[model samples]
Target chain A: MTASSDIDALAAMILARELESALSKRADCGFQLLSSGQEAVAVGVAAALLAHDQLLCSGRSIAPALARGLDPGRVMAELIGRASGPCLGRGGRGHLSQPSAGFFGAHAVVAGNLSIAAGVALALQARRDRSIAVCMFGDGACGAGALHETMNIAALWQLPLLLVCDNNLYSVSTPRAAALAPQRLSDLAAPFGIEACTVDGMDVRVVREAAVELTDYVRNGGGPAFLECISRRYASHSTSARETRGQQELAADRELDPITRLENALLSEGALSAQTAQALREQVRAKVAAACAFADLSPLPVPEEAFADVV
Target chain B: MSSEPVRTRRVFFREAICRAVGETLDAEPNAIVMGQDVGAFGGSYKEFYGLFERFGPARVRDTPVAEAAMVGLGVGAAAAGLRTLVSITYMDFVLLALDPLVNYAAKARFKTGGQIRVPMVVKLTAGAKGQGVAHSQSLESWLMSVPGLRVVAPSNVADAYGLMRSALQADGPVVYVDHKRLFPTSGPLNASAHEVPFGLAAVSRPGRHATIVTHSYMVCVALAACDELAVSGIDCEVIDLRSLAPLDLATVCTSVSKTGALLTLEEGQVVCGIGAEIAYQAQARLGPVRVSRLGAMPAPVSSNPVLEAASLPDAGRVADAVRRLLMEG
Candidate 1:
């Protein structure tokens, strides 16, 4: 294999390793809002990304951000408000930033990144380069007008934009059925004349296949594409959601864990043994311990840092 | 319309605007123009006349009556490296395009940590004299409240040329407010290469007693008032606030600080307007003085010529404000 390919594969592994460690470890520490169900969507997207592609994510993007090579220690550090975090601790967890990985910081405002995603896509077109923009918003975000406006514009201009909606059923406590009008999220882009696709959020391989096709389609001049991954968030909204929702819905979502599906699939294929999966879990635990230690030891930002990085 | 000669230089405001559109296209291969009546009709106000001949249908484009969609398309075009000029005929029509202009075009570049530049200039006409409330609104104040927008209102030929060039070349969105009345107003010529830097006030007339600060066609009224003020022994300096956003507060403040007196003139409503912003800053910077302002009264402008005259601040009101400041001093 080529040196670049080798590096790409290795980086993907490290990112996944770091993410697994960060997610499992920080889940308990950072309000226990773990997204164990959306792992497939995240892994699929992260796998399909070109190194130069920019990933502008919205909140509830734990899996995608981690999958995109966000450092384990930095994710943990950000969660714990440490100096070494992606945003230097100013933006912890949901507001993470990893510029080197091409992961622009996550936005808290729902669907606000729609136009921003178009802007980045436009930037890619302006440079006369081949890089595409990957934006992940929830089904809740599709309801926002900015999303519709951006989709139409992106499609009209044939912009290199890969808009992915990780429909985790609920925005926070409100289900997609409650917040969004159309039952299916991909319906949002149909009127915009953009190509639309859907995938089982529980299957990373399926999602990976879809992403590759869509990315290539857009790269070959197909206009912006929207892919809706009907995923589930197997954890609380944040450290705060567990207290906010009743026990029944959260319990229902737990039954659809993508991590378990991947693990089971690996076992069936003999790529992984039961002992191997257990060992991987143990490794994740150990890595989390090290990252948490690093985060805890990190320093607070100086007073001058406040005025810096205002945007 | 008066039987005025085709003072080509005075009429350069519309020419400069259309020329900038065509020139920008010639300068940058990616430049395009899209709006109602732009392509075939040559624009609703004839500002975009002959653009189709210069750049063809692809670049000199026409868009549907979707104001919000048009702004969104402009944003996309800008992001895609096309210096797109999206002209919404009336400043009042901006109400339809506000969401896109306010939320997307304005903040997209900054919010992305400089990932993109919406180098899109929205050309709009305000201050229509005889056109009723719907058409004559100087909504520059309404649009100025949006952050990340460099709002500009040029009063004369030089500004018309300069501001359009600056807006066309900017890395962010600019709302270039063209006054309906000042379209024919003339000033010093700017030849072929004309550019107006943003956030700098244009001093039409210099004085020491006090400064009459205004923008757009009102600059002419302010100058006329300055002339009247000079007759009455008031050395009134008229400072034209060309670019409204990155406001040249320093210029206004320096003029106010030097002459301990100030008066503001606008064509919009008097309350909670841009004039209020200037008054607040001037009061804090250059102690509370007898500051006066002339603008449209709270009531909307009527079709009656006399009422229309009273609706918007005239040269007499500007001179009266200057006189009030001088008397209080």
Candidate 2:
């Protein structure tokens, strides 16, 4: 991968890690779904998108939102329910969105955003602006009827949409193998006539290459395409949920950490010195600290705000 | 010089809807219609008869029989800068698509801090027509309680056209309910462009003895009851509640104040139905007044003609309720 791409991916991973650390300590952070080990999927897919293209994701949105160029401070403000957030603190973490910045936002419902993303693609197609819509969902969403329905219509209409499945192998405590019957998640798109592929989601380089090729096909009017990124989640589903995996499995999963893998790869190639990696970490730490400070200074919305913007 | 006399053309309820939607498509370049049979088949009730031919396949598109995806796509497209009107063939089927309509479209603007607005209309055909339990329902009351949803029902051609026009132009999500039975009916339509504003009730027939407030096909039932009651030397006012969410309680209370009696009528269930809401609100505003609510029997609507007739409220039932309410002193 190019040096700039590698730096962007590393910065996103660091931001997610720092955000998770900061959010876990706050008492008023509310319920959060963190992307602890799945940073590569978000950053890599976001790298392939143009400024005009819109990206949508599931409830685990901190990584996707940050990777799609949302301000770290504003995201923090929204997460902490501050008035300065993009949604004026109304959306919180699950519904965080900034459509003007091409992040169509996240929907908490599983598989809920699939059809919505197709609709966004339909609108973009109507404009003839060649802007595509990409939706990132979990392996759990593959079992839903909405995904099938969306795929059928999307394929029939040839909407400019890219379906990215961030397969983290578990839905809460349930392992994907125990819950889903699919031999390979990418095979779900075969019947819909959509081009499909599976890749190593732990490596940002592999994820970005696959995303670029798939997005190119979609942008060139090749209809919809599906990419299954086999990744791992280092944390439980939500901050409040109990961990189902044992200590040994957790330790094994950490060995495949996307950040460590990339850092090691760059270090071996002499592309990133130990000094430079330390400097990047310090820079990311300061940025995250400033973001937290901004959120700490931001005020919460007044009680009357509950009734605002309601029709 | 003599001026030409103004003339108004009459049209079927479905044609009025067609004209209103056609006008919207003509005026707004981004407006589109999506639903089962909305394209070449011209909608289940032919409400979208000529839209496909006029707008072409691009704007007037037919979707699969998947109600969830249809509504979700419409909501998503609306939020992404396109005005869409999704048609669900039956109100009963709207349950399948409520996740998107109620959860996403209804809350998009409020949840997004007004940064995103879903300017879409979900047109559902409601009421019983011997279509059986699963296919027949009047679920407008269920949607009325949602905070950001605008619920409107049209009893005649004018309001059908007018409510749809307003719903399409509104900057939020609207549930535009049209009755299946009303599709065959016709009424006079003014040639010039006009729109009926929301939250306004039309006094279909004015009287001094009692007020019968209803909407959709029940408006016709109420008017028929008024006709029956008029012969008995009882003058009853008929108020058509065109919009259910932003209910025009002021007009209802005004009539209740003058008549000293109110009868809330609807074709849906009486328990927690439209009448229950209207009755409570009207009495809350006008103090204690003799009131009665008439609605469907507490049983499932059947396709059997006899059972269907026994399940829903009729003019006779409405008249009897009004009589009972008036006799209460």
DockQ of each: 0.18, 0.87
Regions of candidate 2 where Cα sits further than 4 Å from its true position? B1-5
Best by TM-score: 2
Candidate 1 residue pairs in backbone clash: A31-A239, B37-B43, B162-B195, B162-B196
- List, residue by residue over A143-202, the lDDT tens digit for candidate 2: 999999999999999999999999999999899999889899999999999999999999
Candidate 1 lDDT by residue in tens digits, B1-329: 64334433444567777777777888998787877779888987678889898788767767656566677667755855567788988888888777667766776554443445578899999875777878878888887877778899988776787888899998889999998886665555545576889999977888999988899888888888888888878898788999888789999998888778878889898788888889888888878876877788888887678989877788888877777778786
Please report how far candidate 2 places residue A182 from its true position, in Å: 0.8
Interface RMSD of each candidate, angstroms, one decimal: 5.1, 0.6
- In candidate 2, what are the lDDT values of residues B180-296, reduced to their tens digit? 899999998877777888899999999999999999999998989889999999999999999998999999999999999999988888889888999899888888999898888
Model 1 residue runs over 4 Å out of place are: A1-36, A70-105, A122-131, A236-245, A282-311, B1-11, B29-42, B48-87, B92-124, B128-149, B186-188, B192-194, B227-235, B299-310
The number of the candidate with the highest lDDT is 2
| Model 1: how far residue A163 lies from native, Å | 3.1
Instruction: TM-score each candidate.
Output: 0.81, 0.98
